[model samples]
Target: MTQYIGRFAPSPSGPLHFGSLMAALGSYFQAKSQQGQWLVRVEDLDPPREQLGAADSILRTLENYQLHWDGNVVYQSHRHDLYQTQIEQWLSSGEAYYCQCTRKQIKAMGGFYNGHCKPLNHQDPAGCAVRLHIDQPVTEFTDLKHGQITLPQALAEEDFIIKRRDGLYAYNLAVVLDDIDQGVTEVVRGADLIEPTGRQMSLYHQLKQPTVSYLHLPLALDENGNKLSKQNHAPAIDELDTQATLLRAMDCLGFAIEPSLKDGTIEEIIQWGVQHWSISQLPESTEITPRFSNGSV
Candidate 1:
């Protein structure tokens, strides 16, 4: 029998926040309930957004909360060679092409990109990016949480870049490759990334790799409707009140709260939660953002 496998891949932009814990808990319970392996991965490919020691802080916080992970953690920052190999393989196979078209060129044509560089023998300088060719629709899949979702045509079928113009790999390319590398059987992440579901599915097809299950959890937003993130200055998770924080996160994910267990330890609360965990128990619609009026940064 195939064991269920899931991952919580956090970017090292800042210390793990309340919203981050919700995602980690959802993935953890989903994996643990099925006796599956749950892994932690750091998506630190984008250096500009990464914070110093942020990954270590996140891992320490998770451990303190008793959200233990299986095996060793994987960091995308160390996987550049794998990404390059795949890029080369696709290029040799005519599945990818070098693109020289500017963003303005794409907009002038339409909001969508036409395969302008797919058949070109043009000189693309150091800043050139490699793009994938897609002449057919990438199609749709039913989301475990949000039901049937058909992606935007431009995104699903457009000639999207695999490598960045700055010689870096794009997030879409890196994530698909990393998921494949880690043998991640399922993904549980924020609803904000639901749009990329179809694109990721398309990559699976291109590589002839098996598709993985996905669950996009609702994003935590501020009062202004902005997603709680480093940019929005969302507060870091408080280690002092870990159980309280975890319970609050579970509530945000629609898990039933036990008033009697209010002052319990993290392990005790997690034990109760894992035993009662059920995907059917989670809310299908987007949930309200969990916020503290006292404020934090």
Candidate 2:
């Protein structure tokens, strides 16, 4: 049997908030439960949006919470050559083409790219983004947690961009490539990314690689009902009280920590979690506002 491999990829846009921690811990527990390898990757692909020192801070925070990974952390910024190589191959094989269309033009065309540049065959790489030509788009995929999910026809059929006009590799491109390179067997993250699963699966098909399994946890919402995210100014996890924070995250994942282990150490809590983790116990909803003991998330 092949060893199960999972990862927790975090972007260096800000510190890990409660929602982010839920993803990290969920991935960690899932991996450890199966006695598999759990890896860490810093998705610092977009340097302009990345906060300085945020990557290191994320690693340190993981350590504080005792979420040790199996190998050295992989940074997306260091793997530009790998992405460029794939793009070059796609271009040469006519699987991808350069698009000169701007965001305004795409918006005018029903907000979804209509594959206008494929026939144009724009050669100049200057001021042009590269888009993969989707011959057979994946409209639906079975999520480990959510079951069969069908995507909108336009979204599933759109010739999505692999490289941006600003010379940055798109998230869908980098994430799929990185997951393949790392030999990741499963992707355990938040449901906020559930929409991109089909696109990523399409990339896997394009690359002729088997797609990994996906387990998307429920999205943690804030007081105002928005996702608890850095973009929303969500507060960072309180490192001073790692025990309480870990328990809260576990609760969000549907783990009812036994009273015998409620006051356990961080390592003890993680061990108990791994031994008792069950995907079926997870809440069925995609978005949920977590409830805690003290009326605080």
Across 1-297, the per-residue lDDT of candidate 1 in tens digits comes to: 788889999999999987788889989988998899999989998898889999999999999989999999999989999999999898888888888778898899787788887778444446678988776556688778777787877778887888988888888889999988888899988887888787778888888898898887878776677777777888897888776777778887887798977888889988888888887777776656675534541
Clashes of each: 0, 0
Tell me how far the alpha carbon of residue 6 in candidate 2 is from the true structure, in angstroms, after superposition.
0.4
lDDT, residue 60, model 2: 96
Model 2: residues with Cα > 4 Å off, grouped in runs: 293-297
Error of 2 at 262 (Å): 3.0
TM-score of 1: 0.94
Scored by lDDT, model 1 comes in at 0.83
lDDT, candidate 1, at 77: 88
